[model samples]
Target: MTLLYEPERFKDESRTKRSKRQLLLTKAEEIFRTQGIASTSMIDIAKIAGVERRTLYNYYNNKEEMAIDIQIEYLRNYGATVEFKINHDLDYTKQLESYCDTYIKRFLNNKNYIIFITQFDYHFRHFSMDDNLDRYHKIMKDRNMTNNPAMEIIALICKQKELNVDDQLIRKFFFTLHHCILGVAQRVIFRESVFIEEQDYSSEDIQILIPILVNGIVSTLPSYQK
Candidate 1:
């Protein structure tokens, strides 16, 4: 006779697996924050997690795989918060200002997570990117569009303001300004001087620039009076 399928038993097993995975991630994040992912090892994670090396291997073949999972989860949660804050009905300038404000506010509030992200970006360069495409694919899949959310928002702003900027130019503009902002924030959190003693920048300086930069970009649009 064929055996009966035990759905409840399978569900319990799934929950156990998820719980163990979460425990491992929690321990790994703490260790990665202090030692950096490049300096971290699977053995370190397993030891910190209080589990056998084989247990970690069951969830992830290696540290990079585990780190990728943590990174994706972090991005997904942060993206949800951002999507919730965006007022789609707002005008172009207000919308962009809101987006910038949200980014700065979140970064300030979650300094440790931002630090992890900064370190993760550096560590990610040495690893193969084949398994790292989950976040990108999810973003594309969710939006069902060619451009990323930022690019789409920028394009919308241009259309609303009747700006003559090319789509490629907008893409370039966003990436350039974004990296500048992120780099400044990262340095501030890292407690490094931002090059000007006495008038040296803080996260507050980054905050002040957000509106100025938003307005600066908006004012440059053909429709906005410069």
Candidate 2:
């Protein structure tokens, strides 16, 4: 059976419904990222999107619904970029380089995005920005189009013989990867809070730092099960 997708479902073109959905989503993202989810109201997004308050609700049930949709879109967008780069590059280090560069660049350059994350507190509430993580996980049960961006890249690295790692071990490696990246960034950029007590780490140092961290974590995990 052939799959069918309306031409209007794609990114560009002239379609009011699709366009409004995109506009509403984009506005919600901006509001959430700048003012934070808890602080942002549907009316705020409506004002930003140039739509009526009721129109915002017409698109989303509430702030949580909008937050889930926007956050899910961000994660999927990040994953798609990573997937394209991973599939294009053969060298494992090259893939890792692509992954690391994209990850750091996107987050570090976006200040309002950073403020939202820090304000929402991702560590304490991983589900804060996203209440639909379980839904996403279910979609990714067979490694669907939606999976964590960082994990997607690691899967590509594991495919190469030089990386010499098994698929089963990548999850543990990914957890370490996640915290290492976050910890390094917080240690460098936000020195006023929890980081105030922690030692300072420069971004330059992380280029050398991450490899050591990944290698240690990857090596500690057991080899592929028999």
Candidate 3:
């Protein structure tokens, strides 16, 4: 049976088609996980996805493009699963705590993603990519992050928690979070920093470590006007 086209269901045809393409990317990922990329072929993904080789080609020019697509999907999944959480309904400290706790947990769960992500053909293309592709996406996201519904709520938090704080620091703090993730991923890939499997580590250790890091930064920065 086709994974996407259920026997009985109706929805937006365009959305269904988009999902069908995404399903192919997931199938491609599973194949990579099971057989390893070196042994996997485009034919293997096509067979796994129940799509013809020609159909796969329509979405991606070849395996390199397909690999990039799978990495993109992985990053999107992580963002959806682990990205920031801000609750305007809650008071500032409580909401910040919730967001910090959730983001750290998400990061902890994603420890192994760096290993696979580094293998993608063009995962770091943002800094290296031609302006035509990367710039547009960055600009769109930057605008959204500053003005989106979520940020509007976060703005409320800023007003409540750091009533006298500079708004630029609020933005810079979020940028620091992004930098931390990139730093962590880099160390994970290089096997440079503290690691879970090294000499001694546990989930509890990480739980403790994250809160210390979060609260330390929040406290020392003097950003919290209260």
Best by lDDT: 1
lDDT of 2 by residue, 40-87 (tens): 778898998898998877767777766655544544443323433445
| Candidate 3 C-alpha lDDT tens digits along 1-226 | 1123221222444776667766876787666654655567889889999999999887665555555555544555555233555554666555555665675566566654554554443333432343333533553364445643323434565555555556676666666654564555544543524565674544434344445545555565554664
| Global lDDT scores for all candidate models | 0.67, 0.57, 0.54
| Cα-based TM-score, every candidate | 0.71, 0.60, 0.58
> Candidate 1, after superposition: displacement of residue 197 in Å?
9.5
Candidate 3 to truth, TM: 0.58
lDDT of 1: 0.67
Q: Ranking under lDDT, best-scoring first?
A: 1, 2, 3
Model 2 clashing residue pairs (backbone):
none
Error of 3 at 69 (Å): 3.9
Residue pairs with colliding backbones in model 3 are none
lDDT for 138 in candidate 2 is 57
- Candidate 3: misplaced stretches above 4 Å? 1-20, 32-44, 47-52, 71-77, 80-91, 108-118, 121-143, 147-164, 181-197, 202-204, 223-226
Candidate 2 local distance difference test against the native: 0.57
10 residues in a row with least lDDT, candidate 2 = 1-10
lDDT of 1 by residue, 95-114 (tens): 77667777778778777767
